[model samples]
Target: MISGILAYRNIQNSILNGVKIPHSTSQPLIFGENGKYYLAVFVFFFSREDIEKGLVERPTMWAVADIETGKIIEIRQTKNKEFSDASYKIKYNVRADAQYDTSKKYYEKAFAILDSCRNEIINTDRFNPEEYKHYLDMIVANIPKEYQRFYFDLSV
Candidate 1:
């Protein structure tokens, strides 16, 4: 059985590897439902100038992944309705303060988007329970002994 954290890390790494973008930030959110693990990795694109200005751009792309197999299920480049408006305008003496405020809003939006995606996946019957279990078993069999202790059994 793989620990939840380990699964999350693997899923995040897989998404990051699949989507390559320089000077971008990512936030990966994980959740399990009906014996299946799913992840939505949101990637925010920004340039050096944007960072200097303490701007937090909306997520340009996002990928959905199967945590059990550490594979991307889908990638979306379309903008969501929540972020259709222009970003918030704020000024601060400290760059970090401005970044914090903007980043907080971006993360909140990311969470909302993930929740929406999760609802869709759960309601649409997108996952197969048997297949999820098979992938879990495969992960357990392949994981090294040294790493086993760190990963709690998910089967419990």
Candidate 2:
């Protein structure tokens, strides 16, 4: 039951082909199918206006799959729905993601953020740093060679 906070923009600004949250979920998680350790990541954001447009701003699930070890190291489940009985239903989806998956710069920039933003992450309720970092290493071990740039060591 580990949850993360990814700005509403990160996914929206992604460059991967058809890398939509719900759609691309299986690919990442499937990689863990052959691994030793499994990880599941769930990101949640709240927005009032996004509801009118039918968006998943509340919960974003990202499960990790290690192809060689047959393990699902992580899981992320997204849930975006109305708070029943609540009067306020209009919330803005996370403003936007600052980077795109298709670019190396994106990963580098993200790495910088991860290195400097540990405290911010905890304060933002976007992650449980201790848990996610350990799982991230397990997830990265399965990444293809070319994509390795997207994975980095963020030890603070």
Candidate achieving the largest lDDT: 1
Q: Which candidate achieves the best TM-score against the true structure?
A: 1
What TM-score, computed on C-alpha atoms, does each candidate reach?
A: 0.42, 0.25
Model 1 alpha-carbon drift over 4 Å, by segment: 16-20, 31-37, 79-95, 98-156
108-145 in candidate 2: lDDT tens per residue? 44434333333344355344455545544444544443
Candidate 1 positional error at 109, Å: 23
The true-versus-predicted C-alpha distance at residue 142 of model 1, in Å, is 34
Q: In model 2, which range of ten residues has the least summed lDDT?
A: 26-35
lDDT of 2: 0.33
